[model samples]
Target: MDDIAAHAALIAARRPRDARLRRVGVSRAGTPLWLLSLGRGARQALVVAGPHANEPVGGATVLRLAERVLADPRLTEGADATWNLLLCLDPDGLRRNEGWLTGPYTLGRYFRHFFRPGFREQPEWLPDGAAAAALPETRALLRLQDELKPFFQCSLHGVDVGGGFVELTRDLPGLDRRMAYAAARLGIPRELGPYDTLYWPRLGPAVYRIPPPRPRDLAAAITEAAVESTWYHPHRHGTVTAVVEAPMWGVAAVQDGSPPADRDAVLHAVSDALRHDTRVLKRLLARVRPHLGGTPDAARLLAPVDDYLLVCPGLADAWDPDTADPGRPLPALTAGHLTALGIAGRRIAVRTAGLLHQLVTGAGRDPSGALPELDGLIDAGCAAYRDDSGARWIPVARQAEYQARVVLAAFELAGRHGARARSGEPDWGTQAAVPMHRE
Candidate 1:
């Protein structure tokens, strides 16, 4: 959906006249915040896609869901929820992603076009204050949630590598079974321990349960506070907030079930990489900050790293694999997870360097002198990402279909009045039965 207006028009043509489209507010740059709505059922459900322009996997899934529901209004018959569809929630950032959206959806292409905001400035975690209220997109979402009080709120997001995983407010019954089936059918693996050591309530290989954020966690630092925007309001507790994380590139190593031989070693390696990236990026950023006034997308690029450099050390300090439910098997990762972990850190440095390069060129300066060592770092990181991403790419349409299936299943599972399924008792203390993937 690079040409959002064009896609929006196509969606409008498919849906009935009852479908509504309007600008809810304006983006920071004055781009209209648009929403499309269909169904007037008693229960309200809101689906958000492109919450982060860098993660575009859900863009097609959201559109397909809207199209299906439009063609057969009964698609949501049992759920009895009015669906508010918000696509490209951050068009200002998304437009910056157009360079890679139309191409081969490779990891490198994605990183090249990425423009994620800082955790605090992101749609989900924007600090609640006068400044936040002034953010038209943030305000519009808050207004809609307050007005509708949705029964379900799901934000669509994706990852750079690995497989698919779902995050829900509560551990619902039978959702795991459906999620596993959908991912297997699509030939994608699950991310065993995503970003944080969140492997818990092991419903299945890829399906996971995410608890509500605590006051302490939010207070610890902004990194801990980067809760989904849906959590900002009291109405959120009663609602089923789900996050679907699909990956751009995946491999067999992604789903390795075996535990690492040295958990401490693996944890330290990734944490060190993250911390190193933060320091390196911070130094480069200080040099580039004064010169950013001339770049086309300076703010978009600066926000992520500015926040990242400040909070990364805290995140690394808190890493603990022992806290995860050992009994529940992780979907994938072993040695490969270490590589991916390092790449995540490298991407941050690469992104900052690319932006600095842009700013320097715009200001008519030679990049080598202005941003010494940046080109080498970016080039080295990119070479590593390419080496890892090779032969691991999936078609965007296939990824969408699998995501839609999992989401639809979740809708049924989370419905208040809809048929509920069996809840499996999890064995929280035991070693994983499956072996890890080792080359």
Candidate 2:
């Protein structure tokens, strides 16, 4: 079969025994957008694919859930149990998502290579006023949701390295119980549980807003600035809907090249977490914000991005170093350095620094111990800068490169710890335990 046919077949094979496959639309790049539906098609459940590209995990998860739902004869037995699963909503974004989609399964390697935040360089970011009014993918989703009016409209997304957690629209209601249950079952950190901005109850899940898009009105000097705006979830059409974020750190398993069983063990643990809590999740979905046609003021929704920019060492004196400043630049920071900086800031950085310190001090630290931390620093730094690479205060891209260097050090530490751990002389202090410099 040709590539298109092959893709279709993969979706078909993965579909449950009674589901049907249909082409939803063509991607901007001309690739096909497909939809998988099961049951009687009443549109009671809807799972939308995210912007695709660098993060196909959301699409993959949707597909995986579809397969499992179809296979479970008990749950899918009802005629009224229908779902609309959009596969590859943004094929244009997905085409560029090669490495992570096809690469080896390691979070560290995935972190080093997968880069998509600076979407200006990306093709899919091109929907101008005309395209925005009717981008092929966007239009299709809009029309479908209008017609189906699904009970749950979940836009799937994967969070980056800095942190991982689940989110729900504050206006939509709480799935805290479901989320907490899943995290515990998956063995994900409890601290990673659901959270939200106390100020804007309407922004939905805090995780969905993670490394949120750079605010559009920031200083022009920053190259990697994010454009912050509330997205339109079709379910917001009084359909009782919102987005679902499954952070990568929460899903993908990593090790120092451990056996497949070990990796699968971790993946399944997460999968089970989501699966077991489905009933609780169903209960939570009954209360998303009722759609109000008018959109909210962007400015009111977004605190100005200027506050988050990271300043360079030169600006160090400018920013009262005594106050915890997200924008202050750290020329060459390691995980240890981040912890030290955090220690200096005291309480503000303690949460993140403690997590880093724990991983570094693990008895059998993975060979890529630094990988996650380095990813966190880069994420926090960029987030702090709101992606402004040109900010005079700091050169974010350069700082990012320097942050990568810290990741390399952590990698070496991980390798050393892994070697010793395998040999049964795991030393959590010297090899595994790297302390945060206090005072």
Per-residue lDDT over 1-439 for candidate 1, one digit per residue giving the tens place of the 0 to 100 score = 5455567667776665647777777778888776777776787778888887678877788878877777666655545667788876777777777778888765555555556776655666545542446466777777777777876778888876666777655555677678778888888777654544343344555555554444444334354433445544533335666778887776555565565677667777667766777777677667767765667666756666666565666656654353333564333445545544554556556776666555555557654365556666666667766585443777788788878887787776667322231133342212232332332
Worst 10 residues of 1 by lDDT: 427-436
Q: List where candidate 1 sits over 4 angstroms from the true fold.
A: 129-132, 197-203, 216-222, 225-228, 232-237, 290-300, 319-340, 367-372, 388-391, 416-439
lDDT per residue (tens digit) for residues 1-439 in model 2: 0233355467577654667777777766677777777666443556666564555555545555655556655434543457667766666555534544555644333433343322222222332321354466666666676677654455555443222233332122234344444444544322221212211112222222222233342232122212321233332443433344443432122101122333333333333322332222222212111221132322211111112112122122222223324563322222222222222221112222222322233323434334354446435543432232111121222222222222222223323443454598733322221212221
The estimated TM-scores of all candidates read 0.81, 0.48
Clashes of each: 6, 21
Candidates' C-alpha lDDT: 0.64, 0.38
